[model samples]
Target: MIKVGDKMPAGTFTQITKDGPQKISAEDFFKGRKVVLFSVPGAFTPTCDAKHLPGFVEKAGDIKAKGVDVIACIAVNDAFVMKAWGKAQNTDGKVEMLADGNADYTKALGLDMDATGFGMGVRGQRFSLVVDNGVVKQVNVEQKGEFKVSSADHVLTQL
Candidate 1:
């Protein structure tokens, strides 16, 4: 898994909107900004849908109040699924949902977890990272199936 203070890996992912495709680069997302980035195993899954993501959405206002420029969520699902799931979660355009469809970004960051035993395939571990101007400042990765850390409130405390 990625650790705090490591230079964030370079990667690009697709974000689909009703209009068309939006290509997002990791550097561009974090450059000259204070970004809170969270990752889930997949979209619409139990823990992620119930706790992980909802916490971010609920505390987004507070997070932004602390000078955060962007709050982003990433998963191994494709852009289409990510977009639909974001809408279902009632994301108020406050959080950007990024699709790491082929595990490219996940693997590049060294946070990919294998769950093929349960048929989850290659997926990102549940984690949150704080990036300042494209540099990693903090990282919180939860134990498998556990949601103790890596929540918005937890990261907010760090900020």
Candidate 2:
């Protein structure tokens, strides 16, 4: 998996905007900025909905106060699903909902988890990374079925 000191890979994540779907490149989003990039296996899943995403949304202001330029949530779902989940979570402009629809970014990061047993196919492992100017500064990847790390609070502490 990609670790601290590694540069973020080149990839595109879709974002559903008012004008429709938009493509955002990793370079454009993370280059020259401090970013907190967190990934969930799927959007609107139990743990993700109840804890992961909400934690980031709630702590976004404090995180940004630490000099973070962007707080983003990525999932292996489509832009439409990401948009809907963002709306449901009331994330709106607080967190950028990035859709890694085909698991491109997740695979590129080497964080892809085989969730076939759960009938979810390929998904991203629960993880969070602090990236400064596209280079990873810190990373917290959770063990399977665990949520001990890769949390907003933990990431905040790291920051």
Candidate 3:
């Protein structure tokens, strides 16, 4: 598993937001800015919907105040689902919701989990990374079904 101080892998993915489809690349998103990216197993899941994503949404402003350029949420779902989930969370313009539909980025980062028994093929483990200039400054990966270190408050403290 990747850890704190590791450089972020180069990757790209497309996402659909309230505006439209947008293609995002690692360089464009995190190369020169401070980014706090959180990945979840899936969108609309209980913990993701109720806690993970919402926590980011609630602290997006405070995070920016601390010099974060972007607060992004990534999940192993399609753009439509990501978009809808963002809307449902009332995070239409606040958080940038990205879809890793094929788990390309997730696998590259060595963060993919096999949840076949539960019907999810390959999903991203719940994790958060602080990226500065394309390098990972810190990483917080949650243990299975736990959401402590990856919470927004926890990352804020690190900041």
Candidate 4:
């Protein structure tokens, strides 16, 4: 798993735009920026929809006030689904919803979780990281079926 002082792994993420889905490389996104990147098992999942994404949206201002440049939420879903989830959560101008439909970025970070038993197939684990200019500052990965350290409130304290 990625740890403090390590540069983010090379990968690409899909994000929705006015024109269409745009591909953003990890290096490009993390370079010269302080970012709070959070991941979920899937978009529109019960806990995620109810708490995870909402907490970030609520605290985006507070988080950005602490010198963070970007706040992003990623999930193992298509770009359309992620975009819709962000819209439903009212995250406009706050959280950037990222799509990791192929699980490439999750596996690269060693944060992949198997959810085949739940009929969800491969998915990213619930986690969050603070990255500054492409280097990791903090990483919080939740335990199985648990939500604790990876929360927006928790990350705020760390910031």
Deviation in Å, model 3, residue 84 alpha carbon: 0.6
lDDT of 2 by residue, 52-125 (tens): 99999999999999999999999999999999999999997689999999999999999999999999999999
Our model 2 lands, by Cα RMSD against the true structure, at: 0.7
lDDT of 4 by residue, 15-115 (tens): 98998999999999999999999999988899999999999999999999999999999899999999999999999999999999999999999999899
The order of the candidates by lDDT, greatest first, is 4, 2, 1, 3
Error of 4 at 120 (Å): 0.3
Q: Report clash pairs, candidate 4.
A: none
Of models 1 and 3, which has the larger lDDT?
1
Q: Give the whole-model CA lDDT for all candidates, comma-separated.
A: 0.89, 0.94, 0.88, 0.95
Q: How far does residue 8 in candidate 4 sit from its true spot (Å)?
A: 0.4
How many clashes in candidate 4? 0
Q: What is candidate 3's TM-score against the reference?
A: 0.94
Count: clashes, candidate 2: 0
Worst 10 residues of 4 by lDDT: 143-152
Q: What ranges in model 4 sit over 4 Å off? A: none
lDDT of 3 at 3: 70
For every candidate in turn, the CA RMSD to the true structure comes to 1.1, 0.7, 1.5, 0.6
Candidate 3 overall lDDT versus native: 0.88
C-alpha TM-scores of all predictions: 0.96, 0.98, 0.94, 0.98
